[model samples]
Target: KEPGSGFWLKWLGAPSCQRGSYAFYKSVSSRAQPDGPVQVWRLGEFYFIRCGPQDPVCIAEVTLLWEDQTQRHLLASTRLYFLPEDTPKGRTREHGEDEVLAVSRKMVVRVEDLVRWSCGQPAGWSSSLKLNGLRKPPQSSDSNDKNTTTNTTDKNGPVERQGVKVLSYPQYCRFRSLQRRLQDGARGPGLQDPHLLALGAVRALPNTRVMYCRDTFNHPTLESNTNFSWQFSEYLWSSQQISFRPSACIPFPLFV
Candidate 1:
């Protein structure tokens, strides 16, 4: 792999994994784990993929983790699970926000699209450990220890923990699987440890607004952030989806 080997160029363009032309990885560190205990994605595990700059994230099962040869980029091939809202019937209180409907739709996305679980998710995604059986990070520590701090570093500098920006629709992101119907699709607590909720408190960022409105004609429509300024005039609301995304049952408040 030398300069002008066409890695970055192909990567920037977002090339898909070419058939018979990639290398495999046993696991991949999450591209967007906010704090640190570290989220490592492995095969046969569930995770989320970013769809667009502002669109809601989608949860999928990792089938393969590979590097696209031509682009020299790491990529993930996942089988997506849809929301009941994504179905024709829509959502219900019976279903936990973190639960997802199983489906066979698969897609290839840049590993950068893979994000970790969020704060305050249902118990199914976490076990007694909260890390869901994943291995602990190197030199990781409980934030309770105020006098001691440790971090592994390389030649360039100290390895700082990276955080991802919050999205408006966390409902679409994944955590646990939808179980038997008798349980009302409720998911039990799995295992999770967000770096001690990721070494400290979750970041406090202002949440964007997503409004589902009715025009003078009384037709339902959605008015979201500036980036959402699409031609929504003729758009029709789905009976299955909510007025706006649930977003953790949290209000879309403009104040604190």
Candidate 2:
């Protein structure tokens, strides 16, 4: 007599008693009308389901509706785990004037976008609907290489640059140390910091140009021709003949 009484009957996997049951069953079998979309709702702390028939003897498919209203067909014979008692509850309620209701909630499994059907001869018989969570993209260790030279660029020029000498161990160590201190989580001086200025002085070597050094957001531009200058190459024991001048000097905050 009740609307959802059919659900109980269907869940019980028993033949309906009344004439209406036979009619409903026939409609489901003939037209293959979904009883209803798959739903996720919390009962107390756990979620329960009245998914479509599961018996291999039956001929109905189960479909789940996502938040975006996209429909996904689940594997016919897959077993689904309902929300556990410890799981957080979501807001959803039953349909009106019916013993059964449709609810909305997120799933744990990551369902594919396409719809799947049964593998039967007519390909109609199906079982419970499966729910899945969204998948995350993989992390990349090679992200730093994006700014570095690539194989294609190597063909245009020598793999190494000419007329540029490597920094001595002490000079390199000092520059690297200052860079680490600036990048460390600790709040330190801005570009005006004496340490940064000292590092800049050391980087301004004769015949050795610091091509560019940019921030993650590309806000601060520290290029060889800009934001850098030298009066003499004191580190290399040279003067007058070795004088540097940055096109411009701009100091920007490290944090927004």
Candidate 3:
């Protein structure tokens, strides 16, 4: 584990688990002391290795252990290789300031404002609201006092109350799934939020955004039959199997 020691990174696919008692995997390794600026390695169709000024390289060793009633065993091990020069080491280059487009910056238009303006009621319509730099308008002192009184009344009138709660990461996913459902015209009191209609419109627009999954909703739910620890263990293992990648969704937005 000393600095610059050779290391390994392994990627195992779920399809490989089909082997009755064995697992298949692929890995990349680095030379103990690479002399060049770039080192390249490949394992399978599922990965692309790139070395550039913007990316750093790291290597790790992976181990898998298994235990059974009869004995314990080391299931798998792998090494990963990379080069330090895989990152740029030379003099820096000069760069110019990036140009900003006015239209692109003005993309977020309020639906209500647009409707009123388009209906030829300039007097009734408010100025177009942009999503960027949006802030809630300040409330008047009179309204704040009224809200305080209303809150007091509601606190006294509530039939029952549970503990206050905040959404967890998985619950956020569930909320997004529910939003997708509501967008598809599902009936629910959640539709009472005026902004939900605009959200549904955004989801309905095609080729204009990057979405989590195009065909289905993904949420985390625990099985009632499993023990809490077992359920958590499964969730952790499944989460580790997922790999998130970043790439330009719209490579050339202006040109397109």
Among the numbered candidates, top TM-score falls to: 1
lDDT of 3 at 140: 35
Q: In candidate 3, residue 35 scores what lDDT?
A: 37
TM-score of each: 0.35, 0.15, 0.14
Q: What would the per-residue lDDT of candidate 1 be over residues 128-226, giving only the tens digit for each residue?
A: 112221123223255222111112234454343221221122321221111121135232244233422332222211121111111112111113433
Report residue 247 deviation for candidate 1 (angstroms): 41
lDDT of 3 by residue, 1-256 (tens): 1222232222322222222232333322222233312111222111111122232321211222111112211122212112222223321233111110111111111111111111111221113211111112123345222111111112234221111111223443554565556447674555543454234222121111111211111112212223224423432342223212111311111110
TM-score of 1: 0.35
Off by over 4 Å in 2: 1-165, 186-194, 199-256
Cα miss at 227, model 1 (Å)? 14
Tens-digit per-residue lDDT, 49-154, candidate 2: 2222342221111221111112211111111222111113321342111111111211111112111222222221112221111011112345222111111112
Regions of model 1 farther than 4 Å from truth: 1-20, 30-37, 48-50, 53-57, 91-99, 115-256
Ranking by lDDT: 1, 3, 2
Which candidate achieves the best lDDT against the true structure? Answer: 1
Candidate 3 runs further than 4 Å off: 1-172, 188-256
